[model samples]
Target: MTPSIAGACGTRLIAQVLIAATVFSGTAARAQESVQTFPVAPSYPAAMPASPLGASVSALLDHARTTNPAFAAQRAETAAARERIESAGALPDPNFQVELMDFTNTMRGGGTTLLPGQVGETRYRIIQPLPGWGKRELQSRAAGAKADQAAAGLDAAWLDLATEIKNAWLRYYTADREAALARESLALLGGLEEAMLARYRQGLAPQQAVLRAQRELTSQRLAQVGIEQRRRGAAAALNGLLARAPDAPLATPADPAALPAALELPALVARARARNPALTADERGIEAARLERERTWADRYPDFSMGLTNNRPRGESQSWDLMFEVMIPLQQSARRAREREAEHMLAAADARRDATGSRLAGEIGAAYANFTSGQETQRLIRSTLLPQARATRDATRAAFETGRADFDAVLEAERQLVDTRMALLQAEVESRMALFELEKLVGDAL
Candidate 1:
């Protein structure tokens, strides 16, 4: 080919390559947008509540941890279990007896002898019992396992308490925000109503416009009353969690717990399996069950007892005697039935542990989904829809003032903006709750 022809071909090839690169870049950007996920939690609402409660959520959580009667009761249970370990391995209390032998001979003399020396024979005996072979150890081990299970349960209780406090705090925050947002809307509508009345008086707008504005304002005020009521109820619930009186005042919730970075389902599942209190308790239950089964089997063995007796004859020297006894393990059917019961219980414990693991995975999956969706929903509203709705309302109201648009159009736009704000608040609360729920399942902060 000629040099000119070759140069033209090279230029065409470079142009084609650039075109392909542009297409690929656009595709990559679209793909990234489709799969975008928040690695860290979004910022809390920039605006804080006007009414301040007495304490922050963090403080409330700490107070609940320290003062909640449930936790103290759980601790007491653990201590009680530990105390039982020694009792489980203890021997039966010794038995003591006093006997009058040859009482007929004494009575034959036509006189009842009250004294040991006057009787033909008198005896004193004591016996000490020993538990069956290996029974003490098994019993002690079972008790120890029970104590362990109690400890695990205590850990689970902590997660439960945290979940409750965080959830209640979120509920209060949602209601507070909703009430505040409604008030703002009421004020906005009131202004619009005044303006619409002025326009109606001037014959620039219809009377219906002013009437619609008044209705919306009244409806908003009524809704605010309910929202405030719910907020107060939420506060009461939170106070109860903190072990305070139900009517005790609580501070407004500030921000939600920060979300974990690079949240991954697999990682969360791993953490849950390793540390989830419920799962841990199940494992402890399995161990306790196994020990209990062993203890039941140990019951098939015989228990032994030893005794000593001192005998005295009237007007004679005393004699000492020793005796030993062992329990006969009779009733094979009863023993076997007990063993079967323990076996079934152990199997139940194993099944329970496995089921908990399965449920843990499912819970983490659900929480992860909720957390990601909520964050994305709020982010979209805050970044795009909220602003767009606000702009639409402003534009429509301006048009209505100029007699270029209908009053209903302005009302519709205003309603849309209010809904968007409400939705944003709901999403924020949802995201916060989901993140905390995830942590509760994992038994620790992610």
Candidate 2:
């Protein structure tokens, strides 16, 4: 071979080696990450060290992890699945038999006289059944995979519980903010009522203006009551999630959890694919189905049972007997049906796994989109809409005092300002809720 050609070949071989090394290392790292100690449970922070809202949420989640009945049920199921692995590969229980021969008076044993306790033979046998070769191992592997699936299910259950708690907390947060805003609006209306009354007494405003302000103040107070009622209901729901009495008091959440500084859609999708518990569970289900299918194929082979017997004849020498039993597996139709059933189940599991992946991807996308939109809306309302509304309210009030605008215009501007502020608050809460949902989907805190 030419030197140049040999050099090029050598370089190509080096590149191939490097590529293989990189792939191998990546695979090894991923495998390590996937290997977890058995009976894995969700981890919670030992202490709440963040904001008050975050701390409260963390504490509630910890409480629910141990106290919630639903979580307990899923945990029990996972434990059961784990235990099944031990029995999956076990041999059938050994059988013991005791037989007395010639016990009736009509028969006599060979070379023995027909006398009481001297003519009968008694046998003791023990038999053990062994499964076909490789069957037990396959059964064990299938059970292990099922246990993994159940563990994933338990993880998913925790995620669901966390999501519900977050959603409930957000709801309560929103309601509480709404009630506060309503009370603030009521106070503002009372001040406006006083100002209008003074203007009417000084002959600068009409009696109708004072009456309109009073009417609005009354309505605002009523709205405050309604908002408070909703807030209480939300609080009760949140308490229920925490496994507390409905009337239990909760510490006011001073602030909502902050959104991530940056969220990349592609990165989020990749994380979800890697960490989503639902998808992981489905993947394990596929593995279990495949293993079960292989086990069914292995079941086509015959199993064996062996028996050892010891017999003693009265006034005669002891004898030993050995026996072997084989299963015929003659029901070809039934075996074939089982194989077909396993094949279909594996196919179904694969389809379900694929469907779960697609659904998770869509959910991640939707949550990210909602989160981004909410952030943008909140920014717009805060930077432009709210300031503009406040400015309009102030300008209208000035115009009314200068006899250039009606009191109605001031009241309308105030209402617009109040509505804009509430919208901004709602947007903020919605954005935070979206983040919580995204975290749940990704199976990690963002």
Candidate 3:
């Protein structure tokens, strides 16, 4: 080969090597960058420091009231709504007028003895409109209804805020339990993998056993990944509900030892009907609409005014006259139509309120029933199924060590144990969530 060709070929080879190296370095860096940094899963906090149910409920409600923007906005709006009453009851301020007289001429030769006088009048007058046909009273009632609706609206806001907080708390509880279970499963799988590796190396186990163990370990690792993700998500949601940063640490009381015992459906329905804030708000809206229709009726009549006026001519004494002004508009087709529309709106609001109350009653009944059923299921699992599965696992392990139970039995037992544990955890989680939902639907007993 010529020296020049050789040099070119050498440079090409160097370029290829550089390109390959660059590609590999880029891939490695991307892989590292794609990896996530997860927060250390902190252990569950201690049980609630407070014991009185009322106090605990109040604390939670207070936290939500302050943290929830919806509730805060409603409070401010209700305070603003009070101004509407004062505004509605007030009459228009009286109008004032001022006038000045300039030059004036009196005809002297055009008449006989009577003076043919011209009055260049300057007059000052005040007009105050008197509300006719109980308009003021009707307006005051409407304003009062509006204020009532706003107050009820604030209650609804607080209710929703409280429900959101409770839901978030339950989610955090679920995350904690699931994460704990995942960690425990990981540890157990690790032990099994070690045992499988030892047996395989001793020639007592097939290579496939080691492979299977490795696969199981990897599966659990993946499960842990998902569990951690949920944990972080739950934490972030709770923090946001409490008006903190998504990553902010939270201190939550541990879940209760057991779910509440079942209650009669009738009682639950009653509670919901009495306390559901959304239902209350709807009722208030209906009342406000009714009052609005009444006020519209009063608007059909016009107001009246009475005033005194003074008239003076240039270089002459002032004369005063009392005047009364009455405004009677022609038949108001528009006002009548508006009154009918208000009536229909009031009817619609009333119907809507009734529908909401009915739905709330049904929901509370269903939630209570499901919650109790779940509680029973969890109790049964904890008392019987889980313990039996655990005993089976222990027995299988003992037999394997003694050379009686085969590898298949050991694996089967392990599977059953895992399934039982998972089922129990799910049951517990469901029961807890159901109870939380029930309480949210019906205000806390306390």
Candidate 4:
């Protein structure tokens, strides 16, 4: 009886252990399934941040100055030229030299040696070169003028880039606007087609009306393809300017820019003469050339150098000597050649300045004329032509629905409305682009 009790208790303990093992194994499997072994992928922002620059003109210009390689190159060029201002006036590096005199005498008794400390006499010298009176100042002034010229060149590059950015922005915005218009027109046509179908069912419209409606729908869809292409192309051009990939996505444009106010031709021309980057660059070039000529002429004078020499002689005390030297302007032919070069460069610089000014005036005049005329046309269309077309379209559609007007009349009115809208869009874009060009030439917005 005791042996039976022992066997039964052992069996119960073994069964309990097996049940616990099963529960633990099941939990381990679930825990393994819950855990992840692979690394999570990183996420990146879109190519064009939403509201980056907020489409502000200043923000855009600043961003371009920071990112565009060509613009950055211009900035670097300006900086390098400006650096010459400091270096041009600096005194020439002082000369230093050492001489070991009769060192072999010390080696006469001892094994041959060439040590400075064992020499019989040693000499050390330092010389400092100084330019003639007014020479260094002239050189510094010349460098300053050159730096100004480089700065003007950088401004010119910026103006050109700004115009391109503005034009591209306008193109992108116009494409979107045109697409919206097309979509609206498509929806309106869809409603009109439905109305036409109902009329046909009631025996109020002809069968061809339904076919014409379908055909118009197809044509509208085809037009959207071109609009989409325009948007993509504009986006690509903009991305290139922003130093991004051609296919990078861009956020939608914000509010449109307001129309700029008008200015008189004389005023614009005067402003262009004063602030235009090309003209300023040319003027600075003339100044630089003139200063360079003066600086070169100053080079015809002699330069002076002061030197200190230390001397020691065998069986003698050390002595210090001060010496002065003058550089003679002996290369007469070379000086004459350089002078002639400077004169020619000055002449060329003056001529370029004149030509640049004349060209600037003409460009400003032409842009002003175009911008003014375009502005007037845009205003007229917006105030009069567009409203008239819209009214005509609404009236014709209503009349056709009541059987008072023909289907041809309704189609003609819709076509006229579309054409008028397109004309308005084209006018606005062209005028704004003209304004941008004008501003570029003037070097500031009017």
- Say which candidate scores most in lDDT: 2
- Tell me the whole-model lDDT of each prediction, alpha carbons only: 0.74, 0.75, 0.64, 0.74
lDDT assessment of candidate 2: 0.75
Per-residue lDDT of candidate 1, residues 1-446 (tens digit): 23233344444443343344334433433332232222221111123334454334555555666788988898888899889989988888999988887665644464665666566788999999988789888888888888888888888887788788768877877787677667666766766676666555545556677788788888888999999999989988888887888888776555444444448888889989998989999998999999999888888889899999999877778999999998999989999999999999999999999999999898889989998998788778868997788678667755664457787887798789778777876776777778878878888865
Candidate that would win on TM-score? 2
lDDT of 3 at 260: 52
lDDT of 3 by residue, 1-446 (tens): 23233344444443343344334433432332232111111011124435432123334455555666766778999988888888888887887765543323233222222122333446777777778867777787778877887887776666566666656665665666666666656665566666655555445557887788788779889988997788788778876776777887665434344445557778777877887667777877888898888778777777798887777654578789787888885668887889899989999999999899888877777777677777777778768986787678767766655447766686677678667666766665666556656665665541
What local lDDT does model 2 show for residue 131? Answer: 91
Which of 2 and 4 is the better model by lDDT? 2
Q: Which regions in candidate 4 have their CA more than 4 angstroms from the true location?
A: 1-58, 103-113, 247-249
The candidate, 3 or 4, that scores higher on TM-score is: 4
Q: What ranking emerges by TM-score with the best candidate at the front?
A: 2, 4, 1, 3
Clash number for candidate 3: 0
TM-score for each model: 0.82, 0.85, 0.77, 0.82
Per-residue lDDT of candidate 2, residues 68-185 (tens digit): 8888989999999999998998998999987777766246535544444454877889999989999999999999999999999999888988888877876776777677667666
Higher-scoring candidate on TM-score, 2 or 3: 2
The deviation in Å at residue 401 for candidate 2 is 3.1
Give candidate 3's error at residue 306 in angstroms. 3.2
